[model samples]
Target: MSDSGLPDGFADLDPFVADWALPTRAQRYEARLSKPYDDLVSFYDAVAPRAEEAIAYLNGLDINDLPDDAEKLLQLLYSMILVSYAVNVFKQNRIPDSGAAFFDMVAEPAV
Candidate 1:
């Protein structure tokens, strides 16, 4: 956790574009592309479901229960969240309106 009481995962994930990747992915279907951030909340809402699923999947997980791949998954998820935040700030300009929804959900996919 940071100075705030948020758990490590909470700090690392992108509140925006949480599960918004699917549509954003589809919106750019067939195009060679960079990530989008224009409406941070929009993307977050779009992808929120994926995050929720991820959380539900991860809930109650114990370190011993994790597979060998668990560590890698954690790193990947953190990296993706950072990337999503950066994409939003530099490319999308600000968090989309749906950022709140993104936060409401607890899990997200790796980029």
Candidate 2:
């Protein structure tokens, strides 16, 4: 844990992402494409639930008042929160029958 007592899981994400071979966006996307269900479940298990604490810790801070580097780190931590939400709460893996693939934003609103 850091001096602030945050979980090492929250304090450092690089090791976690690297451990899963998903340290980069492209690698994560590939994991989703190649192992959609496994990747989502794995990521959720590793990062979610635990991420709530991290999110809460970050939320408790005054982001706007933080130093530039600290703010950037906080932003990255928030990204982890978002990813956990998507994978765990949303359970987004593949389209109903479209096979395994990464989520693509809808180009336009569904009519």
Q: Total clashes, candidate 1?
A: 16
- Error (Å) of candidate 1 at residue 61 is 1.2
After TM-score superposition, the amount by which residue 67's alpha carbon in candidate 1 deviates from its true location, in angstroms, is 1.6
TM-score (C-alpha) between model 2 and the true structure? 0.43
Which portions of model 1 show Cα errors greater than 4 Å? 1-49, 92-111
Off by over 4 Å in 2: 1-14, 18-31, 34-36, 64-92, 98-111
Q: Candidate 1 has what TM-score? A: 0.33
Name the weakest run of 10 consecutive residues (lDDT summed) in model 1.
23-32
Model 2, residue 32: C-alpha shift (Å): 3.4
Deviation of model 2 at 108, angstroms: 15
Listed in order, each prediction's TM-score against the native is 0.33, 0.43
lDDT scores in order: 0.41, 0.49
| RMSD after CA superposition, every candidate | 13.3, 7.3
